[model samples]
Target: MNRMQLAALATVATLFTACGSSSDTGPQPVAIDFKALVGTQTFSCADTAGYAIGTGTLPWIPKDFRFYVSNVRLVDAAGVEAPVTLDASVWQGYGVALLDFENGTGNCTGGTVETNKSIQGTVAPGSYVGLKFDVGVPTASNHLNVQAANPPLANSAMYWSWTTGYKFMKIDGLINRATPFTFNFHLGSTGCTLATPGDFTTASCTTLNVPSASFAAFNPTTQAVALDLALLFAATNFDTADGGGAPGCMSGATDPECAPIFPKLGLPFGTTPAGSQASFRLVTK
Candidate 1:
């Protein structure tokens, strides 16, 4: 009555242990948060810089700041890419999220009063040595019909249409003169070709200015990614207007303002700038 019963109970216990171990071996889901900043200051439309970019010396006052990031992933020490799943919402779609730091006050009329301070997503739980992502929508989702696209893309302020595609990063502000003049930087693909305006098909743009980044240290739990506005506008003159009448770069190849910004974003000048990225930092708390 004892020996056979003992053996049966031992076999059942071993099977249960094996099943438990197998179930816990897969990757666990983790949440990662990204915070935006201008230098060390918490980014806000109300912030102002005493001086403008370059020698023209227009008074700088931040009015609006927003951008998009996509294809987010984490890199382990062994150099393996860990895929992340983004939370889908009005501000997020096509594997990307739109970050808006502006609240439509002062000189910023194109933005909303509500602001988005952080971006949250889920990734496999692990110690990540690096973080990688794109600055704009990829070609697969970039040139779609804006009316039919996701909420982030459908917004008229972010999309220009089939000829121009989406605005990758929009940093707008006022450079005070007799009146407050606008200094806008709308980054996106340029020189696109399509059969017609109404066609929903994708166009091949000569410059897909989707700059990205790879950081040495990125842990969502302990670090926050920052975008420094001071460094970004250092290369441009806010007072000077180019042939197009805009104060700052609009991803134009010939725009002098774009030269310094290209390197900052890790993109090659006068090219598509597809595989280039730089301009994300990890801040430890």
Candidate 2:
């Protein structure tokens, strides 16, 4: 071959190699924003006289209450549930770190408390089908020693020394007209027979199965998950007249209210209502 032809061939080869490298780089990763909408609703007694004591705030009923939710999940269109694990170190950047009573920790008061916090992360571009996660801490991680917790997980007030575990969910406030009218909806593993003096052990305790659920098929790229706080109280039976606070009131013994509340909170074990299911909507922007 002629010298001129050989030189041209080398140049062509170099150009093709550069083009291949550019194609291999691919597109940038897509960012996904996760949000949780939380709130409460007022319910009247069975007689319909006035709103539930704990549900309302007045001179007599000073402790008008609210429930805390954390540890949200994001599901893709393929039905794969991705648990949005919050960084236990930094509570301010994401939102307030509320105590998860389901684990047995009482109400988390310290460290910028966030009711309905929203967070964002990067995920490969794809269609997400739905999202699901626990409204309370799962049985496994709930048994941690609160006294030893640090940073985001360190809150002395929420620790329940008597129970030996954290409160999974605390729906306490006021329930009756009595002074300090209160109905401590402290829900956790009832038959907690597990006992370990040191090193914390769950070898003997019965694991309480908290309920959770998901919503209808929704596209995440264009919609955002909106957790409705109001529906959480309305749909469930909040009738304080009956055993509303009974069976489970501070008992930690697997009460009726415990069963219903978890699922409504978009938990894995609770019932998912049609309207309540819309608690979370997906959006692209």
Candidate 3:
């Protein structure tokens, strides 16, 4: 091979290497900030500072509630949804696993006060289309043996031993009328009858599964997701003058309160009304 021909071949080889390198670089991933905004409402009598709701002092009334959301799924640009399951074994330093409301508490059996709590996670850059998750604890995990329950479950405060289940929703606050008062809006499974006298025995009770709701359209880069407590009890049936109270709704059934309040707050049901159906939207930058 002549010197000139050898040089030309070397140049061609270098150019091919550069082209291959560029092709292998692929697309860069962007950083995405994801958050879960959670809040609750209160059914209180009227006095001055609107209806008391959430964590506050000297208002109409405060109804404080917490939710434990896990096993979150994120949708990507390719129209593919990815599941982001977190370590549900603990919550905020407390030991409490995920709670399945459907199957009762027997499946896993024990938990902590912090069990089934909601937390936020970081998402990578992608065009998220929608989100999906279960609302209540599934039946398999719901009906666990309370005697063998862990810390939070062993606490007994959250458990309804008499009824052989747990309360899915605890809506409590002070109610005011011509005066001031309190209202307890606790909903869960009732009419429970045990099949056998055992630690994790099945109960004759059943829970209702409410469908999830879609709250908003979100783009992680351009928007933010937040849960507005004000919208939760906007239609609450409470009046100070008349001692008004919110209409009761069964937890596992198509309760009136669950339908009106949840949907207004951005949660909708698809087929089954047990869990919530909604995607987190980017509300702020």
Candidate 4:
């Protein structure tokens, strides 16, 4: 009785150990790095002036730079994709994240000391050869009340109000000239309407304005995503302020100033077709 009982217990313990070992490998942490750049050089908040940009190569003082990234996915060598389940935190939550490049220094007065430089999350344990994500918050997440929203969404600097929803991206710069003026590129969904006067939960926008990108050769460990301000403003005139929604593009469908900028975001404005998104590109970390 003693020999048989001991032998049976040892066999059961071996099976349990093997099961535990297999179950231990559930998911792996995946982080895709990103950077804000002004062409070849990495961007810094201390540089207040003299960044060459725009059609005429005019100098401008960079003020603010922040944007959201969502629906992150990792792609395999054979083109199969898997969504990265984002870890909830102050900089990321509810399927969205704020990639803040400003640190409240120099001319970036509206920025905060805190900054987030990467999309942090986990994916199914496998080999990923590429990355893909959206450049804005989704509709269900975007059309909610900011006061009642979660982490990154509650960041007032990245928000507008109830009716208009959150700003997808906010990049501003003051044209360095005799009559210096601020050019705000506040992008969000426009042509929205709420069933009730102040109920943002009921708001529906005609234009979603969310741009997407897929990098076929991205290696999360050895590469980084670069958001190039120089490429963004390449086709835009920094000096001119069209008589439209704001001094610069405000995601307004009919704003002439927004027409050129939206295409740079890989978004279509008015009747113009969507141009290739030149603002985002790959770079070595």
Clashes of each: 0, 44, 48, 0
Q: What's the TM for model 4?
A: 0.87
Per-residue lDDT over 1-285 for candidate 4, one digit per residue giving the tens place of the 0 to 100 score = 477765554443333221212122366666778899998767777887658788765576778999999988888778999898988899998799899998999888978998889887777755567788999888888877787887899878888773457888999887855577788898887778887886768788888888888888876656789999888888887766566777777776677888778888888988888866778999987
Candidate 4: clashing pairs of residues: none
TM per candidate comes to 0.80, 0.54, 0.52, 0.87
lDDT of each: 0.68, 0.40, 0.40, 0.79
Worst 10 residues of 4 by lDDT: 15-24
Superposed on all Cα atoms, the candidates' RMSDs to the truth, in angstroms, are 8.2, 11.6, 12.3, 7.9
The 10-residue segment with the lowest total lDDT in model 2: 16-25
lDDT of 1 by residue, 36-123 (tens): 5555666666666633445457756777688888887878779888777776777778877888877887666778987765555555
What are the runs in model 1 whose C-alpha is more than 4 Å off?
1-27, 48-56, 162-164, 195-198, 239-245, 271-278
* Quality of model 2 by C-alpha lDDT: 0.40
Q: Which runs of model 4 end up more than 4 angstroms from their true locations?
A: 1-24, 162-164, 195-198
Better of 1 and 4 by TM-score: 4
Residue lDDT tens for model 2, 31-64: 2234422333222111123233224343111121
- lDDT order, best first, reads 4, 1, 3, 2
